[model samples]
Structures are given as C-alpha cells and as structure tokens.
Target: MIALLLALGSSLAYGCADFLGGLGARKAHVLRTVLVAAPASLAVELLLWPVLGASFSPSAAGWGVASGAASAAAFALLYQTLAIGPMNVLSPVAALVSAVLPVTVGLLQGEHLGTAGLLGLPLALVAVVLVSAGHGAGGARPSRTALLLAFGAGAAIALQLVFLHQTPPGSGVAPLIVGRAVSSAVTLTAAALLRRRLGPEKPVYAVSAAAGVLDSVANLLFLLAVRSGDLTVVAVITALYPAGTVLLARGVLAERIHRGQVVGLGTAAVAVSLLALT
Candidate 1:
C-alpha cells in the first residue's frame, strides 16, 4: 500500500511538472525550459545528498548518463508537441506508450505479469486508442508529426526508465547528477543548433524552476517506489501521470474533451485499479 501510494504521488508530481514544463516551453523556448529545469533539479538533489549519504559509482554514473541523453530528447520532443498539439490527445498517447514499453522491458528481464496485469494491459491499450481518437472543439486533429514525436518521446522515456533502474546500488543522487548534467548538455546543444533564445523573463524563470523542483521530487518518489515493488507495477503507476496533466489542462487551459475521451478515462481508471491489485 505504501509503495502504491508513493507511486501515485510520483505520478501526480510528474504530471504537475510536465504541465508547468509544457507551459514554459510554449511561452519561451523548448530547450531553454529544459536547460533551466535540469540544473534546478540537480540543485535539489545536491541539497538532499548530504542527508541522504550519496555514493559515487562509475557504473551507476554511466547508466545515468545514457538515461539522461534519452530523457533529454524525450522531453524536448514532448515539449515541442505540447506547444503545437492538443494536450489531451498527445499526453495520453505518450503516457500509454511509456507504460507499455517499460512493461515489455520488465518482461524481457524475466518478470512475469500476473493474471490481473495481463487483463489490465489490453484495457489500457484500448484507453490509449480512444483517447487518441478524441478530437477537440473544432474536430481539429493533431498533426501526424506531433503524434510521431510523441511516440518517439515515449520510446525515449522507456529507455530512461530502464537505464535509471540499472544504476548501481548505494549511489544515491550521484547518478541523478550525472544524468541531469548529460541531459542539460544535450538540451543546451539543441538550443544552440536550433537558434532558440535561451533567456526568458524573470517570471518565466520562476515557472521553469518550479517545474524542475517538482520533477526532482517526482523522480525521487519513482525511484523509491521502484525500490519497494515490481518495476512493471511502478512504471505503470507513474505513467498514469497523464491523469493529473489532463485534469490541469481542463481546469487551467480550458481544453475541451470529446465523449470518447470520457469513456477512455473510465477505461483507464479500471485498468489502473486492476493493475494496482496485481
């Protein structure tokens, strides 16, 4: 129960962070948002390290660096998609893919899905399709490019999740530092290559920084949850982050949902519940 609660909290924190991140990217530059967020996130982990008693392991650091690169690309594409696409449609597709990919990875790692997991998996896939099929007020569909980018982001996210889990024991936040540093470098390079303005207004900086803090917290909780339970379970729970993101978009952005999306949400809820009991 504690693990489940932690996973849920992680999902919410991740959702909130992604919401703020998408907003920041839309208002400023996509790479700039990530550049600012990475160091801020790293700072929080650094602050926590003393009390947490971190260790430095080369293997863990390498794993983190690899994961960082994948995650950087993922976030960049995701933010770009969010900037131009309907949040409700893109988020659920990305979330579903992210969940499914890691579960596949876990299975390859010799973790067998129980009966509930097998039943829930198909339902979640159906939810993903229904949510993606939903159109906004004018029946405008997301561009094919945006959907492709979202799928790429999901694949990258799966790589990040798997690599982060492979971090050596007792490394603590050292791996996080390495990972974020690598990610930051990639984001900065991408920003330069794309000729994006890196400087944002003071107010935007606050939003970006807050996004970082929330992300750091979310990642910590995810790691904790993974440590306490099955990786497949934790990954699915964390991928449910779209739930919070969708709610926030509706409330703050006034995004309208389709009837199919409502049904999709119900299916997602049933799927999550079944998976939880697994």
Candidate 2:
C-alpha cells in the first residue's frame, strides 16, 4: 500500500513536470529549456541528500552514471520526437514501451505478481494509451524517423528506471544525486554543442525550474517505491502519469478532455484500487 501511494505521487509529479517542461520548450529551443531544468533538478537532488542521507558505494555510482546517461538521452529523444510528432500516437507508444521494458526486466529477475496485480497491470497499460490519446485529427503522420526516436526514447527511459532499481539497497539517495549530477553535465554539454541552433529566444526560466524540481521529486519517489515494491507493479502505475498530465491540461490550460481520456481516468482509478486491494 505504501509503495502504491509513493508510485502514485511519483506519477503525479512527473506529469506536472512534463506539462511545465512542454510549456517552457514552446517558448524556446528544447535544449535551452533543458539547460535550465537539468541544473535545477541536480540542485533539488543535492538539497535532498542531507535530509535523506546517502552512501556513494561503487555499485551505486556505476548504476547512477548509467541511469543518468540514459536519462539525458531519453530527455533529448523524447522532446525531439514530440516536436516532430503527431504527439498522440508517439506519446502513448513511448509510455507503453517504457512500462513494458521495465516490467519485462522485473519478471526476468523472478519477481512475481498476484492475480489482482496481473489483471490490473494490463488495465493500467491501456489507461496509459487512452490518457495520452489526443482528440484532434488532420496532423501530418509521424515519419519513420520519428517512430524510431520514440522507441529509442522509451528504451532509454526504461533503462534509467531499471538501472536505478539495480543500485545497492543501502545506497539511499546517493545514486539519485550522482545520476542527477551526471545528467546535468550531459545536458550542459549538449546545449553547448547545439548553441548555434538554439536561437536567442529565452525559455520561461520559472516554468523550467519548477519542472526540474518536480522531476527530481518524481525520481526520488520512484526510486523509493521501486525499492519497496515490485518493479512490475510500480512501473505500470508510474506509466499512468499521462492521466495526470491530461487532467492538468484540462484544469490549467482549459484544454478539452477527450472521451478516451475520461474513460482512461476511470480505468486508472479502478486499476489502482485493484492493485491496492491486493
């Protein structure tokens, strides 16, 4: 139950962060938005160290670096794919693949789920797809390159989660701190390389910073949840994050919620309830 709650919180935080990051990216280049957000994320993780405590064991450091590198790639690929996208199709594809890969890894590692969990898991995946489905039509179909990028982004995201889960149990938040630090460095390097392409238009700094803070919180929660819970369960629940994003769009941006999303929200609630009861 505790793990379920933590995963839910992580999902909410991630959804909010993505919403803000998307807003910031709209105002400036994706790299420029991340240039602000990545450092801010690292700062938040640093602040958490004193409170949560950390031990940078070699295993933790190695896994942290791996996750961090994967995270940077995921961020770049995901944003670029979305920019070129028919977002509705690509978003769900990425989300589903991210969840599926982690779940597969967990199962291969011999984690088992109960009947309720088995049922709820597929429903949660369906909800992920439905919630991310956009209402509009008539956009250009996604190219083969966009599809490949989306798949790569999803794989990167899954690797990040799996690597974090592989950290030593006693490492606490040390892996997260290390991961954030490495990701920040990578983001800065990418920004530097792309400086010529990144126009002079400034990103919304406040929005980007807020997104970073939330993203850090989300990662922290996910790490904690994975440590305490079955990765298969936690990953699927976290993948339901798009529901929160859709809700925020409705409430904040006054965007229309589609029928698919409404059903998805309901399905997500039911899925969570089933998982909790188990």
Candidate 3:
C-alpha cells in the first residue's frame, strides 16, 4: 500500500513537472530547456543520493543512459506535437502509448494481472484519452506531421518506461544520471542541428529547472516503486500522470476541460482505486 501511494505521488509530481517544462519549452528554446533542466534534475538526484544508498553498476548506468536519451526525444517530439497539433489528437495518443508499452512489456515477461489489474487497464486507457481531450474552442486542428510526431513521442516514452523497468534495485543513481546525461546530449545536438541558440532566458530556465528537479525525483521514486512491487501496477499507476498534467493545465492556463476529460479523470480515479486494492 505504501509503495502504491509513493508511485501515485511520483506520477502526479512528474505530470506537474512535465506540464511546466512543456510550457517552458514553448516560451524558450527546447535545447535551452534541456541544458538548464538536466543539471537541475541532476542536482536534486545528487542531493538524495545519500538516502538512495545505491551501489554503482555498469549495466544499470547503461540502462539509465538509454532511458535518458529516449525520454529526451520523447519530450522534444511531444512538445513539437503540442505546439502545432490539437491537444485532443496528440496528448492522449502519446499518453496512451506511454502507458501501454510498459504494461505490454511487463505482461510479455509473465507479469500476470489480478482481477483488479484487468479492470484497471481499460479504465486507464479511457483516462488517458479523456485527459487528452481539448476544449472544443480555439486552436488549429492537428496537422499530419504533428500527428506523426505525437505517436513517435509515444514510442519514445514507451521505450523510456521499459528501460527504467530494466534497472535493478541498488544499482545506484548512476542510471538516472546516465539517462540525464544522454538526454542532455540528445537535446543539445537537436538544438545545434536546428541552428537555435541556447539562450539565457532566466525566467523560462527557472521554470524548466524546477520541473527538472521534480522530474528527476519522480524518476527515482518510480524506479524504487517498480523494484519493490509488480511492474504492471507500478507502471499503470505512474502513467496516470496525464491526469495531473490536465488538472494543472486547466487551473493555470485556463484551458477548458471537455466533458471527456472529466470522465477520464473519474475513470482514472477508479483505476487507481482498483490498483490500490491489489
């Protein structure tokens, strides 16, 4: 029960961080966001290093780097998708892919679901879809490229989850650090390729940095949760992050929530309850 609660809290914190980081990326350069955010995240992880009491392992480090790179791409593509596509189209697709991929992998590895887990799956899927539904007001409908990128982001996010799940407990923070390092490299390369300067935008950087810290902490907690419990349940609960992101957007950006989102949120709560029962 405690592990489940920690996983849920991590999910919400991650969602909030990602939401703010997404906004920061929109207001500033993507590369700049990564550059500033990665270090901030690293700092937080390092601060918590003592409590982690992790022992270093080369394999775990490798997994972290891989996880980091995938996540960076996921973030970049997701941000690009949201910048141009309708929220209804991109957000849910990406979120669903992220949730499904890890759960699928866990299932393939012989992770059997209890009855409650089975009930949670469809509800979780619905929640992702609803949370992603945009207010039917202003905004251009999704473009072909934007749609493609959204799915692409989903794939990358899925890869991130799988890689994180691969890391064993007590492998140290090296995995997380490696992931950040790889992500930093990937984002920096993307920035350079786009001929965009890494700007000194303090306000945007500050927001991104704070988000990075939360994100890093969430990653650590999630890894711990997965190590301590069933991967399927942990992944499902953590992937409910879209709920947090949607709630934050509705509150801060005055983004109108469609009825779908409301339904999604309600369904997600039920799914969480089911997972808790397990």
Off by over 4 Å in 1: 80-92, 128-148, 194-203
Q: Over the stretch 1-278, how does candidate 3's per-residue lDDT look in tens digits?
A: 77688788878988888788878878777667767888898788777778776555887888888898899888878878777767667787888878888888888899887898789877877787777666642465677887789889988988987898898676867688778878877777776787545565543867888898989878887887887877777777787887888889889998777787788889988988887777
Q: Using lDDT as the measure, which candidate wins?
A: 2
List per-prediction Cα lDDT, in the order shown. 0.77, 0.90, 0.80
Error of 3 at 192 (Å): 3.8
Candidate 1: give the clashing pairs.
Answer: none
lDDT by residue for model 2 (1-278), tens: 98999999999999999999888988999788888888898888888888988999999999999999999899888988888888888988899899999999999999988889888888998988888878644465789999999999899999999999999888989999999989989888888888899999998999999999999999999999999998988998998888778888889999999888899899999899888876
Ranking of candidates on lDDT, top first: 2, 3, 1
Candidate 1 lDDT score relative to the true structure: 0.77
**TM-score, one value per model:** 0.84, 0.96, 0.90
Pitting candidate 1 against candidate 2, the one with the higher TM-score is 2
Best by TM-score: 2
Candidate 1 lDDT over residue span 1-278, tens digit each: 56677877988898799889878877776666777787899899889889776677778789889888988878767767767777657766776788788877777888776799788767866765564443542545778998898888788887888787787657787777788888888877787787635554333788899899999888888777776776777777777676666678889999876687778778878887777777
Off by more than 4 A, model 2: 136-140
